[model samples]
Target: MEFVMPVFAGIVVIFGLVKRVPVFDIFLKGAKEGMLLLYNIAPTIMGLVFAVDLLRSSGAINVICNFVEPAADFLGFPKEIVPMVLLRPVSGSGSTALLTSLYQDCGPDSFAGQVASVLAGSSETTFYAVAMYFGSIKVKKIRHTLVAALIADFTAAVMSIITVRFFT
Candidate 1:
């Protein structure tokens, strides 16, 4: 395993050299482009981080959780997962932290833990992804992206509950 990366790199360099490609120069060029790309998306990333922080610190999460509690119950999702469900699309780390806490508090075999695990695996940080990719490319009109992504997230959450219930 330790040698895998080096071997892969060596193979790539050798292949590039054999193909008469300037590997080092091309690597430098790609690196420069990557750095500039990161610079372009840095603000989007920071904004997401800031938003997640605000969501937690503003007590808005608590309010939102309480507001969504009845729906969560009716949907057969654990009330403990309210935060995870809300935050999953906004921030992966935030949702993952909630999932981890759920696992610790509820035990991995508990319904809350099972639901959290399934939710974590089944969905993505939609807003962050959209902001990064669309912002980086400077896409102005996101016609169906947001709607489609939200629908997918909804499906994942519903399926997470049903699938976990069935399996357990």
Candidate 2:
């Protein structure tokens, strides 16, 4: 398996030589373009990382979870998974930490842990994806993308709970 990539690369180089293609020049051009794209998107990625750290360190996620707990309970969602649900859309690492905590506090066989596991698998890091993709292309106006992504995340959370409950 480790040799597959080297073999494939050798074949590509051989084929390019046969076709008289400038493989080295093309490789250099692609590498330069990738670096340029990274340069263009670096600021947005940094801002997102900073904001996620601020929210986590400032206890904003806990505050939001507290505020949402009642509504979540009323809607039949597991209140214990509130932090994971809230953080899942914005930061994958944050939600993963929250999920690990849930597993430790509630046990993996518990309802909350099961729901968190399902939610983690089913949902996307919507804000991170949108920021990275749009930032790479320099699209300043996202229109309804944020709203649509949030709605999808919410649906995934709800369905995760429902699916877990249905099976268990």
Candidate 3:
């Protein structure tokens, strides 16, 4: 594994030399472009982090989970997994923290833990991804992309619960 990168780099250098390509200069250019991309996307990432922190700190997630618990139960979703479902589309880290908490509270062998694990694997950080990608490209109007992504997230949550219940 350690030698793989060096070997790949050697192959690339040899290929560049044979092709008379300025590999170093090209690498520098790519690095500069990556930096510029990071610069452009940094604000979006920061805002997302701040928003997620604020929600967690303010107990907004708890409130939402409480309000949604009835519907979740009606739909056969575990009460303990509500927070993970709510956060999964918004922040990957937040959802992961919720999943870890669920694991601790309910045990990995518990139904809620199994559901959280499946949900985490099944969903995407929809808002974060859309914000970063569209923000980097300077696309202000997201059209129906946000709606579609959120719908997919909801579907993943529902299916995660259903699949886990079926298996268990």
Better of 1 and 2 by lDDT: 2
- As for lDDT, the candidate ahead, 2 or 3, is 2
Clashing pairs in 1: none
lDDT of 2 by residue, 66-106 (tens): 99999998999888898888889889988898999999999
Model 1 residue runs over 4 Å out of place are: 1-11
Which candidate, 1 or 2, would have the higher TM-score against the true structure? 1
* Model 1 error, position 131 (Å): 0.7
Q: Which structure is stronger by TM-score: 2 or 3?
A: 3
Candidates' TM-scores? 0.89, 0.83, 0.86
What 10-residue stretch in candidate 2 is worst by lDDT? Answer: 78-87
Candidate 1 local lDDT, 9-63, one digit each (tens): 9999999999998899999999999999999999989988998899899999999
lDDT (CA) for every model shown? Answer: 0.91, 0.91, 0.90
* Superposed Cα deviation of residue 29, candidate 2 (Å): 3.1
